[model samples]
Target: MTVGYILGYDPDTLREIVDPEQCAERLDEIGEQRSLPALLERVWLLKVLGRLDEALVLAEQAVRVARMGGTRKDLLRARVLHATILQNRGAFAAAIQELTTCAEEAEGQNWPLLAAFAYQHRGKVSYDAEDFVTARTDFKRALFLRQEGGAPEDQLESTLLAVDAAERRSRSSIAS
Candidate 1:
């Protein structure tokens, strides 16, 4: 699980995980030890395997488990995962709603990292909806917040999304 968390955040590292199938099997074996994190790993692995339905279920479970005595921060992550699953399923409104909740919570708690993550995901949702203007705003906010408290990868990813949003805006303007 330790290794999984370390590798899971970076797609490059996540892709390099030796034998994902074997890793999944091993995770299941020891999952009973620490259920929440284990469940989250399963969620991510299933998502990586393109099993969105299964990942969604596991993400819901993770959120439920988090609600049971988990910290607010933990619940935030679980909600974020849930929001991500919803987004993948094409439920953009619900996903955005969840992300909005995450953003509010993060802002209330003054957690810049979580706020940036929420904004980034919101930007993704907006981008998916082709609301490039809104996406650009969200991505810009995410980039700024990440610059303050997040990893460089966060800023880079948000910047990429921002670029996409800019291109989209330019294309739309051209069509006008």
Candidate 2:
């Protein structure tokens, strides 16, 4: 799988019911690579496979590696992924706090794509926390950033879907 696929927060993928056997197969295919990118990929895969403990450890290592040697973009990306592991582990406050910092850094750097990625994930974390209003706001920001940055069709579509989902949920919550 591509790095984008591994690192991205794809609602479609999350919505699907993963098979344990297939997860095991995918884990085996990943084997024992030790590169920074490989660690990040492993973090993503482990998170997807419901191995949050392992994912968190790898995610921390990835962040440390990126901070020490990788480029600014790499460090931001690693931090975003690390925050996602926190989100998956139900650390909503911590995840939101980190993502907010990541988003601000990306915006200050004028990296629209990175900003969009951070906002998009922050939106997901907010959604999981049942903060639909905040989720909608963050998703809309992500959509605008993606559009301005000319993100890929899939990324744009994903943001669009997230916005729609958040809007619907927000409305339902208000009606209740």
Candidate 3:
């Protein structure tokens, strides 16, 4: 939320769409760097670049490494990224399952921001699957969690947009 640098890049600007050339440049810069942050950044880059298979492989590795050497939060973050790659790959059920667990764990740990992220991504997966009602519910929860967690304005606005989209879809589906 602080718009910090990851591998010399601001992740917020590149979240949804990464410039392929920039991504390639970063990958080149990250050459032979197998650190956790480097691996995670690589996973994000590969994912946005439509290299889902490679992303998944790296994501799984990130999870393993986090489990072995990182904090609990690190493991959860790695799992979330892994689940996101699954969501991107059309594995809706698996993604939802993983996100559900991640959300619960984050909530149990009183990590509202992380829970919001899980819920938001889960809602996106539901929306992609045409489960508009579930999407709306999840998005609303994410919005609430974001607000409660005092997230950045842009993050709250993003969740609001998602909630609005899901609500519209839900209404249209009901009308049909």
- CA lDDT of every candidate: 0.73, 0.85, 0.83
- Using all chains and alpha carbons, the TM-scores for the candidates as numbered come to 0.76, 0.89, 0.88
- Shift in Å, residue 154, candidate 2: 0.5
State the lDDT of candidate 1 residue by residue for 1-176, as single tens digits. Answer: 33433332332111223456765676577565447777777776666556789789889889999999689998998898788788778899999999999988998899988888798888777776767677778877777777788566735663664656556674786699
Q: Could you tell me the C-alpha RMSD of candidate 2 in Å?
A: 2.8
Which parts of model 2 have CA positions greater than 4 angstroms off?
1-23
Query: Per-residue CA lDDT of candidate 3, range 22-127, in tens?
Result: 7777877887678889888888878878899999999999999999999989898899899989988999999999999999999999999999989988988898
Clashing pairs in model 3, backbone N/Cα/C closer than 3 A: none
Q: 126, model 2: CA deviation in Å?
A: 0.7
lDDT of 3: 0.83
lDDT of 2 by residue, 62-134 (tens): 9999988899999999999999999988999999999999999999999999999999999999999988899
Each prediction's number of clashing residue pairs = 0, 0, 0
TM-score of 1: 0.76
